[model samples]
Target: MELWERKLKECFGSAVVDKPKAINNEMPGLPRYVSEYLLGFFCEGEITKENLKETNDYIHEHRIDAREKEVFKKDLLLKGSLKLIDKFKVKINLTKKKEDTIQMEIPSLGISDAKVSSDILQSNDRLLIDGLWGMGEIVYNEDNKQIQLEKFKPFQLSEIDLEELIEMREQFSSDQWLNIMVSTVGLNYENYNRRQKLILLSRLIPMVENNIFMMEFGRPGTGKTYAYENISSYSRVISGSQVTEAQLFYNLTTKQDGLLVQYDVLLFDEIDKIKKTGIDEKVKNKLYQYLASGKFDRGEVEKVSECGIMMVGNLPPGGFSEEELLERLLHSSITHSAFLDRLAGVVPGWELESLKDRRKAYTKHYGFAADYFSEIIHKLRKKNYNYILNRISLEGTTIRDADAINKIISGMIKLVYPNGELTDEELKEIVDIAISYRQFVINQNFMINKDPELKRTISYLIYE
Candidate 1:
């Protein structure tokens, strides 16, 4: 094992695992967190061939593919009852007057309207929200032709000590902690230089902070979407060209809250293509409003959410300047100065290396288990580090610019020094990166609009 891996294991113990070996390529449909949880449970200690085979066999038997829905249903009918591992959610049918209105959706088995007992619902309240992934037992009532969920056991980590996680930061130096974070996200720390690593870490600012609007555009296959998709279940990735205000904010017809209210982070991947589907002016206006102040109004409903927004896309392979790349890659609706100014930071994804060869880019060392790491990030969002901003001064920056820079600094501190501990030099380094990120947006806005007002210099000073 590597030195860093040994240190991580010594500190975190069972919370860490061999990240590369946690998933089997053959079992492709399961999410990274689910795969890691099962792997960690079955293949404890040194993962051997026997353990791997046993894990794979269990997954194959329990994981029901959409294509195998009919087969599983047939078996359930013959056996009178079935127990399987799947994600199931409860939907209360307000329209139904009967007591059997509490329905369960077993997504994997393609079964909707399965009756769920009130006891199960009380035990797993999460089922009413985004649902829970775990073992579920379903029995068929032949007379009524209804399926009932009798039992459930969630696989996700139910409770985490945020204080303990914060305390653990004291065990490593800043550099070592940075490397450990990089590895936690499944990247090989040794493969990236310091600057490149910072750029990668910037992708996580949204995860650690709330209502942070950011964008990253660069070459393809850079693992832009991989981290957001696999790192946490609280984040949702929308890749297609079309995005509606109703889907993002509130749906009037369904009277339901949208993605922004449901997740910690909403990542819009392939942003360049979103313009092709045509985002109308109304949607753009609503998006800008929400980005500015985490609140949106639709008809009679007005709600506030803390979900962060991240936009990511690929720049066509060429020698175009950064200004030209921004012009071509940004969605048409958000190209104006007003929309650009709301962004807290803009990551230069071009600086990061590609993940074309998984063997070369992915980490082989021990790192935090996916579910555990995700929970830590989710919990970190509740921490307030804006108080640290009082020690720094910004010159010649507008309110928006200062707010944007402060958020980045706060997020950086939260990620690196969650225990609220840092040196003067460390604070300076974080401030410099934060300013540069916000400056990139300012520079791009000036280049596109040629507005003299956007060209102001933003500098920061740390006060002892």
Candidate 2:
């Protein structure tokens, strides 16, 4: 075993899994976390053929395929009930006056009008929002021709020891910890250089920090959307879809909160296509306001959300100047200085190679199980690391720029130095990277709008 892999296993133990084995046995239509959860449960060390077969058999029996929805329904009817592991959500039918208006939706089974008990909904209120992955029993009620959700157990780690995680970080060097994290995200650390690895880690900033608006534009197949989609259930990805004010913010008719309020990170994948699908002007206005501040007002509803906004899309095929790249990649509605300034950082995804080109891009070594790693990241979000900013002073930056830089620096500190221990050189390196990220936005802003106010250089002095 490699040195880093041995260190990871020593530090994390059962919390780690063979990432490549998990990927190899990945079930179609299931997130990485779900599959890794099973792998970690069944296989403590290496994934043997016997254990793999058992895991695959369990998935085959529990997970319903899209094409087999009708078959499953018939079986449910004949058996009077069926149990499966799937995403279960509840939809409130306010228009209906009957008590049966609270309905359940099993997307995999194509059943939207299933019945659910008040007790179940009360305990798992998260189902009311975007729902959650869980093992649920559906009963076919002959008297009413209704499918009822009889029981449920959420498919997530109940709790994580945040202090234990922070203490474990002391066991590994900074480089080793970085490698472990990259592998946990299912990437081969050897395939990426130091800067490329840092960019990949930067993607987790939104997951760990609050109200961090960022964008990443690069070539297609660069795995830009991979982390958000597979890393945690706390984030939602909207790709190649039109976003409405009601769906993103709040629905006045249903009086239900939208994706922005429900998720920690709301990512817009293939963001360039969102423009073609057409977004409402009101949605854009509210989005801009929310990006600037975490609060938005719509009709009689005024609410605050700490959800971070992240946009990832592909740049045009041909190479262009930095100014043209920004103008072309960003939707015209949000290409102005106002919206650009709200972003904490802009990752140059073009610097990283596509996973398509690298055969060994996926890590074959052991790393934290996806469920455990996700829970760690979710818990990290509640932490306040802004105190790390006390060690630095900004020069020649507006209040917004400094704030953005501080957020990036704090986020990096949370990811790399969660124990709050760092040498002078380590702190300087993080500060430089943070400045460059914000400076990328500033340079593009000045070039596109030719605004002298946006052209100022951003530099920082480290306090001894």
Candidate 3:
């Protein structure tokens, strides 16, 4: 192993960091959190071939038997439930109090109502009820269909201790922290140059920020969709073809809040797949309105959800340079410049290094483990790194550039300085990468639209 990998192994260890199929997207059709919790809790903190096999064998040997179905018919059956904990979209129930009943969707099992306690609802964001099954109030109920939850514990990631967090923040240097973060997200620091690494981290920035919007357009095989899909359970990625207002904002059919309310990061993969008019004008307007200010109404319900939105698409590299591509895109109605302008930063997708080029890279050291780093990023969203941007003084820049600078700086806060501590020089290093992202959004628009007036507004966006 290289010195850094060896040092990381010694420092973090397998106990603190374990590979799970969930966070890596090695498993399909299940949420990342669900798979990770099962792996960590059941697989004994190792993700090797031997550990996985042994764990699977053990589970089959001890799982609930089919014969027990009769025994689970009476009393408060301790059945399965999916709880969003304190996190949820509200349903206005005139007859019942807000805390009394919440819907839990189990794929194999049917949805059930639990007469829940405030304590039970406040425990975790999402959980899979496990081990044994019973009926109402922990016993089998023949007549009542409701399942009462009796026992539960939050995963190591969802739970936090203030003293321990402060201690860890003080214990590690920023570089060490960055290296750990990279490895934890399943990347090897040895394989990437600084630029590739930054771009990789950029894909994750959406997950760590609230209400931030980003767009990345490039050729296929650049890992844009792969990055968003595997990173966290809180992300909801969809192909743009089937999107509708009901799906994006609220589902009139299900009488439920849409994807935005359920997830922390909403990713639209291959946006070019959706026709220009396929997205209703109302839906598009609502999205940009919420992007500008975090408020929207679905049916009779008006609510606010904090999530970062990411849009990805492919553009042919050879047909036209970005300058001409922008003109073609604007005129064709594939996407309007007005809608594109809503994005905080537009990623220059061609700049990212492809996964095929970096396939040989692997990390020898352990990081924070996949799920733990995800939870850490979620917690960091509550922090304000605006102070770092406030310290910056720029000359002859429009307010849009200023906003871009702030949002990009906020991304750094979530990824690099989650503990809200960093030196000025360290902040500057992050700022250089951030400014480049902002510059792309501004320069591309000016070049495509020939907005001489707009060009003058972003004189400071250019970096030589």
lDDT of every predicted structure (CA atoms): 0.83, 0.83, 0.59
Kindly report which residue stretches of model 3 are placed more than 4 angstroms away from their true locations once superposed: 1-15, 18-34, 42-51, 58-101, 112-119, 125-140, 145-150, 153-158, 161-176, 252-255, 275-278, 317-320, 326-337, 357-364, 419-425, 457-464
Q: After superposition, how far is residue 290 of candidate 2 from its true place, in Å?
A: 0.8
Estimate, for each residue in 1-464, the C-alpha lDDT of model 1 and write its tens digit: 86767878987777888877773332477678877877777877867889878988987888887889899999989988998888898877666668656778998878778998889899887787667788888999888898999988777777878898788788888888888888888888888888787788889899988889998987888888888988787888998657787888888775657888888898988887765665777778888898888898989899999999888988776655876666777665777899889988888898876777878888867778888888899888989876678999999899999988988888888888999899998889889999999988898888887889998889877887
Looking at candidate 1, what is the lDDT of residue 113? 82
Query: Cα deviation of 345 in candidate 3 (Å)?
Result: 0.6
Model 1 pairs whose backbones collide: none
Instruction: List residue ranges in candidate 1 displaced over 4 A.
Output: 23-26, 98-101, 275-277
lDDT by residue for model 3 (1-464), tens? 44544555565444254432434423333334444554665655457677666645543432323464333332114443322221122233334566543644322223344434446446543442121111112222346655444444443454544334544554567766666666666666666666566676777888877888887877777678764665465777887645778877877665667778777888888775553435566777788678767778877878698878887877755655765554443323324455556667767677755556544444445566555555667676776766556677656566756776677778876676667687766777777767777666666676756667546433333221
Taking the tens digit of each residue's C-alpha lDDT, what string does model 2 give over 132-233?
888888899888888998888887677678898789888888888788888888898888888788888888889988899998888888789888888788
- What TM-score, over all chains together, does every model reach? 0.95, 0.94, 0.78
Error of 3 at 341 (Å): 3.0
Model 1, global lDDT = 0.83
lDDT of 2 at 273: 73
Note the clash tally of each candidate.
Answer: 0, 0, 18
Measured on C-alpha atoms, candidate 2 has an lDDT of 0.83
RMSD of 2: 2.1
Which has the higher TM-score value, candidate number 2 or candidate number 3?
Answer: 2
